[model samples]
Target: MKAFLASLVVALVVAVGAAWLLETTYQSTAADAYATNGARVGDPGHNLVGTDWYSSRS
Candidate 1:
């Protein structure tokens, strides 16, 4: 019926709006963090070029 259709549309709109808001908030926060911390967020890889068990298979 009309009520169901209207509710579906309202729900879709709310979902889309919520997704947009979350994305925007995340982007803003990430930008602020990057501006302050300059992309050195975590430690570098430890054994990337070493002869470990997996690397020695070749």
Candidate 2:
């Protein structure tokens, strides 16, 4: 039982670390790709994920 608990803790730590690493990698890649194409990163005006329905522009 003790060994199983230790293994479980190790597995959890590895999974969390992998998730964090992947997120960081993805963000960096996205930023690099945008920069290569002359697009700005993190600009809400050019958000690709959602629409800005609240904007007052015509």
Candidate 3:
């Protein structure tokens, strides 16, 4: 049980850290767009996300 708890905590920490890094990366860049079509940078209608959180709006 102790080992399980330790692993769980470690997993949680890693998950949180990864999420934070991804959020920061997404927010810091304006060239990337989280669109369903998966287009390249500098293309028209990139549908950029304005906020730090994930948005459904294109």
Candidate 4:
């Protein structure tokens, strides 16, 4: 049981490391993809969470 727990911990560590590596390698590509998708940074598109969150044009 102890050996199995140790192996599980090692595997989790390796998986997390691989995920971090991939994210680092593709960081720019991911950002470019998102930017190209018209999602524009800093623009979350107001959907009105409440009436008080917006002001009337009239």
Candidate 5:
């Protein structure tokens, strides 16, 4: 039981770490693609034609 618990903990740690790494990598790639396409990162209206309704909400 102890060994199983230890293995489970290790697996959880590895899974969490992998998920974090992939998320970071994806964000970096997305930012690069956005910049390449002339869209400003983090801007809601970067590529939109009309006003960003979400940001314009009062």
Candidate 6:
């Protein structure tokens, strides 16, 4: 029982960390995509995933 509890705690921590890492990675990719396109992304106020990148406007 003690071992099970310990394992559960470890699993929870791992899950939380993995989720955070994935979120950051995804957001970065979205920002990069917008930047590569070179058209200003309008405000939805916040990034859906990654950094908020303002593209060059004509």
TM-score of each: 0.46, 0.46, 0.47, 0.44, 0.45, 0.45
> Which ten-residue region of model 5 has the weakest summed lDDT?
44-53
At residue 45, what lDDT does model 6 achieve?
Answer: 46
Model 4 over residues 1-58: C-alpha lDDT tens digits? 9999999999999999999997888556434567765765544445438656665775
lDDT of 3 by residue, 1-58 (tens): 9999999999999999999998887564434554445655465445655557675797
Better of 3 and 4 by lDDT: 4
TM-score of 5: 0.45
User: Backbone clashes per model, in order?
Assistant: 0, 0, 0, 0, 0, 2
lDDT of each: 0.69, 0.74, 0.71, 0.72, 0.75, 0.74
Give the higher-TM-score candidate: 1 or 5: 1
Looking at candidate 2, the ten consecutive residues that score lowest on lDDT are 43-52
For model 1, residues 1-58, the per-residue Cα lDDT tens digits are 9999999999999999999988977555433566545575443345346555464467
RMSD of 5: 6.8
**Each prediction's Cα RMSD?**
8.3, 7.3, 8.1, 9.1, 6.8, 10.8
Candidate 3 global lDDT: 0.71
**Which scores better on TM-score, 3 or 6?**
3
Model 2: what TM-score? 0.46
**Model 2 lDDT tens row, 2-49:** 999999999999999999988977555556567655675675446564
TM-score of candidate 4 on Cα atoms, chains taken together: 0.44
Off by over 4 Å in 3: 26-40, 44-58
lDDT preference between candidates 1 and 3, better one = 3
